[model samples]
Target chain A: MEPDVLLSVRDLRIAFDGVEAVRGVSFDVRPREVLAVVGESGAGKSLTARALLGMVPAGATTGGTIRPDLSDRRGRRIALVPQDALSALSPVHPVGDQLAAAVRSVARVSRKEARARAVAALERVGIPDAARKARAYPHEYSGGMRQRAVIAMATVNEPDIVVADEPTTALDEEHRDQVLRVLGERREAVGAALVLVTHDMDVVREHADRMLVMYAGRLTELGPADEVLARPRAPYTAGLLASLPEHAPRRRRLPALPGTPPAPGALPPGCAFAPRCSLAADACHATEPEPQQVAGRLVACHRWADTPDLLQEAYRASS
Target chain B: MPLLDVRDLVVRYGTVTAVDRVSFSLEAGETLALNGPSGCGKSSTALAVLQLRRPDGGEVHFEGQELTSLTDRELRPLRPRMQPVFQDPYGSLNPRHRIRDAVAEPLRVQGRRPTPGEVAELLDRVGLDPSYGDRRPHELSGGQCQRAGIARALASGPRLLVLDEPVSALDPSVRAGVLNLLADLQDDLGLGYLFICHDRAVVRHFADRVVEMREGRVISGWRRP
Candidate 1:
């Protein structure tokens, strides 16, 4: 493992009912960096993030290894901000009490001190009148305020890494940006790295320092966010980018990638994405391509060299 | 005449005013989008236009006839001309019923028994396989379920579709496919669409005219040249 790396994941595989959902995925989280995991539904991005905290659903089997074993140090060294703020919080208790309880669980502190820390955490996340708001239950707080309270709870223990899974999927654009900004600021203040799992490309472009694109439970591309967005090296990544209404030219129809992702149990013989890739060839269907160095990134495609030209041709043909 | 028109629409819940004097119009074969943040009364306006919720004050004119002045019995015949497609596909559909039955429901409500072949045709028209008609809503993917919803909406032979966040829940790739299907349907049927969406990029690409809303009022609007 590199000395600067905070966590190293190697050949991680998660399966259920004798079928693999995440097949041999590997990546690293560097210190204090934001790493965004981008993929569509059933692509196993959420399962991968849950595996980091040893929180995969029951009946699922996990393989391979995660260095440092941060699962045991969940609250103190690693924390999770789930999608539904209400579920993460208990409706019966006051918001401040829950956060204070979280602090007291990890550290030996008086109730007064824990309560004080909780209020400060809420204040740090831009919660107005933190002391007064602390007494309110989860249901009493508004949607945006509840999200901020969850962020405060996650950062109260000052974990080394925070894994947020689709934290703003239910929010509109205005509230989504506000939540992301608060999450970013809180993580930076606590000096913790963030592993954000989201399908929104705009969120990745704005918040991520690095990005990992997943397709059919496998790594398709991993590189610096800006570089990958500017010039994608994998066909799947390029297709996903082109499908965004904001990225494509002003037209009636977008260049959508045809076909849906193969189900986990019914995956194709070779590369899982071959059925949908416009750049697929005989070699692509014959064997799954391994990730290799290509243009300052690691791309898993048999025809990485031809991706740029082929993509341009495909766009022109469609238009 | 415009396909649909509203003047000074108003909706209230108890003492709170949700849609305060909002107005917009749509022509056949065109898309008019209602874009705004949450709690901006976009959904209220849609419900009012559909007459699912009677507006407290306004004139809703559809096909040169005023809808607000009509009674329940009078509106019954006109209801088939306008339909709604909601956000959550699974929630919008009856989980226990098969897709074929769901698609046939609109015709059944109008005192007609649709043939199975007609149901299959509706399924095929929305880009779904005819075999999908046999399966329940849960058996289909999110995008497929949404397509099934659209098929049901089309069964009514509606001239206008009130699409409330129709593709917001699907993946990006699947959303594009659904959007394209909607475009083709509009062109073929000459149907007007009242699209309600929050994503600015999608609204820009899909709507022929956009009415921006804030706090239940139209803040701005634009149309393609």
Candidate 2:
């Protein structure tokens, strides 16, 4: 393991009923870095994130290895900020009590000390009147406030890493930005790295230090956020970026990616994205591409060299 | 005259006013987006425009006919011309029903059996294969189910569509396909669209005009140059 890397995932594979959902995958989480895992709904990004915490669904089989075995020290060394804030919290208990309980569970602390830490965590996340709000149940808190509370809970233990799975997907634009800002601020305050799993490209562009683009449970691209956004080497990455409304010119029709992602266990031969790739060739159909160094990034596409040129041509033709 | 016009719409749930004197108009083959945050009355305005919920105070005119004053029976005929496609595709559709029967429901509600292949044609029109008609809503993916919902909406032969965050629940790739289908549908059928969406980028791309709302009121509005 690299000394700078906080954790390393090697050939991580997850299966359900003998059907592989996450194929061989590898990545490293550097200290205090934001690593975003992005893909479509059934892309197994969420499954991969959950597997880090040893929280895969029941009856599912997992393979490969995650270094340091952080699962044993869940709250103290690693924590999860789930998608739904309401589900993460107990409706019956006051939000503060939950946070305090979380603190007490991982550490041997007095009730008074734990309660104070809970209030402080709430304050850190910018919940107004933290002490008073602590006594209120989950329902009493508004949606945004509840989300902030969840962030607070995730960071209260001062974990080394936080895995947030589409934390702001349910929120509208204003609330979404606010929640991300709070999450970012809290993670910075705790000096914890974040593994953000989201499908929103804009969020990835704005918040991630590095991005892992997934396609049909396989890595298609992995690189620094700015470089990947600026010059994508993978055809799948190019297509996904081109289809975004914000990135495209305001037109009647967007240049959408041609087809839906194939379901797990029903993947196509060779590369999973070849069927939808405009630049796909016979070699792409015959053999799957392995991640190779290309322009400071790792791209799993045989036609990585020609992706940019083809992308420009496609854009010109569309415009 | 515009295809649809709403004037001084007001909806109150007990002490809370959801839609306060909100007004907008739409034209045939044009898209007017209602853009705002959640709880800002965007959906309430849509419900009022569709007459799905009778506004406490307002005048909704469709094809120059006032809809608020019409009884449920009186509005039945006009309802077919203006259809709603909700955000949740799976929830809007009956899980137990096949896609074919769901699409045929509008005609059946009017006491007319759909002509042979009409349901299949509707499904195909939305870019879904006609064979999808044999499957239920749960048997399809989110994007596929949403397409089925759109097919059902088209079965009524609507001149106006109230699309309330139709693509928000879908993935980006799937959303783009659905949005393109909507644009093509409008071009081919001259359908008027009252689009309600919170995504500004999508609203900018899809709508001809935009009505920005906040705190139950129309804060501002603009049109594409």
By summed lDDT, the worst window of 10 consecutive residues in model 2 chain B runs over B115-124
Tens digit of per-residue lDDT, candidate 1, span A98-203: 9999999999999999999999989977788999999999999877788878888988998888899998776777767776776677556756789999988889
Against the true structure, whose TM-score is highest? 2
The DockQ values of the predictions, listed in order, are 0.69, 0.70
- Tens digit per residue, CA lDDT, model 2, B185-222: 99999999999999888998888999999989999999
lDDT, candidate 2, equals 0.88
Kindly report which residue stretches of model 2 are placed more than 4 angstroms away from their true locations once superposed: A1-3, A309-319
TM-scores, one per candidate: 0.95, 0.96
Query: With candidate 1 superimposed using the best TM-score fit, by how many Å does residue A209's alpha carbon deviate from the native?
Result: 0.9
Give the per-residue Cα lDDT of candidate 1 at B151.
98
- Cα displacement (angstroms), candidate 1, residue B174, comes to 1.0
